[model samples]
Target chain A: MAVQITTQEAVKKIRDKSSVMIGGFLGAAVPLKMIDEIATAGIKELTVISIGAGYRGGGVDIGKLVLNKQISKYVTSHVGTDPNLIKQIVNQEVELELSPMGTFVERIRAGGAGLGAVVTPVGMGTEVEEMAEKIIVDDKPYLLFKPIRADVAVIKAHRCDPLGNLQYKGMSNTSPVMATAADIVIVEVDEIVEVGAIACENIGTPGIFVDYIVKGHSYQERKNVYEELWIATNKL
Target chain B: MSRDYIAKRIAKEFRDGMYVNLGIGIPTESANYIPAGTEVFLQTENGGLMFGPKPERGESDPDLANAGAEPITMLPGGAVFDVATSFAMIRGGHIDMTVVGALEVDQAGSIASWKIPGKLLTGMGGAMDLLYGCKRVIVAMTHTDKHGNSKIRKRCTLPLTAAAVVDMIITDKAVFRVAEDGLYLEELAAAVTVAEIERLTEATIMNIGEWQESEMS
Candidate 1:
């Protein structure tokens, strides 16, 4: 059973200096309304865990937090798209911990699955090797990355039933894993349907993992939002 | 040679039925030049597989996007999954080849594309994993920087993306293959001479094989 809440109420659950996981890749599947609420709430010193920075050029979605100086630390795989975030990191305002995209997601999955750590050969001979502990098994070298768990996770989905069974339309990105790796999971969805509306096979995130649900903009509205931003940014 | 010419040359390396991942910038443009008869599936780290070309302006879907955050279309047989599964496909060695843009490439096939230390804060997105997992790693880039300094170096001064992972280098001027022994020159763009290459490239060319002129008019 999940409680339906407003975006304002959802942001209230996140405290300053909390470890938060935001699910999205660039800008595709972000919880925009919740992020907006968080930005408005002026939460500071957050440890934001995400796969990458928000859309190219910044000042959109998660980039809003960067502009607000809300995040104290960013745990992510890529930040090339957001110049604002880059500038902050360069100025020593935001601490950055980076890993390969694959390894970043795997660490989250490992956290959700209760694994100790993940051993990978992906960063064996690069700067990534300096970030993690190196281990040798059978004469082959691998890097050991610890699991990542967050205080709260905000994710976006296409639809959800009253019971909070989520169904994603396209590109689930990091939501599903982030949903499982958080203490409190707040999901923003386009629509809320009847209890049995979402078929079991179609459920992307089960109600067991979701704590709260917030109704967000519909598919068309989100499309228009991105279209406007893209046009403004000369990306369209 | 233009960036399109570098991408076109890189596209020639693809084989039919290959599952390829293209990095941002010029490597992403190589998708448009994939061979006509070839059946290549494009994988974006963002979670979509077998994605097609960019969507028309008004026809774009908010949920459908490439790794670069640009609107994209999925092919008829395409599928979408979560990020964990997407990276599993990458790290599991399911991707056949990956084409990525590089800032510098050393003679030992090591690449430095992710960071420029204190200057550029661009983090390594998935380049290290792609180089470590993909069956083949092809670097698509210009031969020199805007200042005419060679990017092909004896040693990369910047932080490396991965060491000894590049299988091929397709630049605006030449093509080189990395082997266990050393780097070998395989092809040259038209009107480009060996003397020019020697002056432009900083790394030692171990061997000059039979030079095949690139099909660039």
Candidate 2:
């Protein structure tokens, strides 16, 4: 059974220098309240694994961590969207390790499934091959990437039952896999319902993978957050 | 030639029922020009597939977004999944075509679009995987940089996204088909001359067929 916890309590589970997996693509499906709490807690030297840098501009979503200098290492597929994060990576302030987006997600899937590694030909003749071990099988060459497991995973979902069955409304992105690949999974959801409320078929993440649940902003509130940011950044 | 012209030309590559992935920047513009009455499903690495056009300002959904993180709408038959499944569709060669922006492309059909060494460090994102797995890979970019240096190069100076993966190159001034032998000029923008193209492009035009004049309107 997963216990309901406050966002502050959820952030307390993360420690300095911990390898943390943040589940989201850009700002969509991101755990904003939990990310804010983690930033306010001032945790430092984190090895943050995410799909990309935060939303397009700086100082939003996971970009807040970059502004706070909380991350020492970033394992991501892209950083071009966030200028602050790019500056950190360019200036040697944050060590950056990148994998092609497909390969990156496969590695996390492999971790969750208890696989040793994944081999693919996607990066055979590019700079990505330099970052991994090359193996040949039956005269065919492939790059092998090791699985990635994190100490804690922070994810967002649309709704959750009291027992922690998560249901996602739109793009789930990396949350489902991150929920399984971490030792402690903290999920932020917009609403909490009865244990039997979420149908089994609708459950995106089962309670077995979740450790704690934190209530997040409502749908309208979340929409307002992005709308305000978009207007402020002149993207609207 | 304008960016819209480049995108319009690239959009002709889409076949009915094709599942296409569009990379960020100019490649995203190709979606707006997808041929009328051609039902092509748009796939985004962020997890949505068969997504439609951008939503109106006040009608946007925070949860529904494209790979570029811009608000988007899903078609009637669209579906959403987790990131792992999304990439599986990409790496498993389920995507029919992909249009991407490039920093440089060489005579060998190799592309360099992800990095610029110490100056810029944007990671490859999904370009490498898309180029390697998609049935057809098309590059949509300007013919030259702002300094008038050709981006179609004899050899790319930047890091490679993938080698020998580009099937077609669509630029503001011309369209080139990448064959196993070499690059072949297949079309030219209106009012653009072969002499001008030869002077600007760094890569040798292996063969110039009876090239068609591209429609500007």
In order, candidate lDDTs are: 0.90, 0.89
Chain B TM-score, model 1, reads 0.94
Over 4 Å off, model 2: A234-236, B209-217
Candidate 1 residue-wise lDDT, A61-109, digit = tens: 9999999999999999999989999999888999999999989998998
- Per-structure clash totals for the candidates: 0, 0
Best by DockQ: 1
The parts of candidate 1 lying over 4 Å away from their true place are B209-217
lDDT per residue as tens, model 2, B5-57:
98788888989999999988778887888878998999998998999887777
Supply the DockQ value of model 1: 0.78
What DockQ does each prediction reach against the true complex? 0.78, 0.76
Give candidate 1's whole-model lDDT.
Answer: 0.90
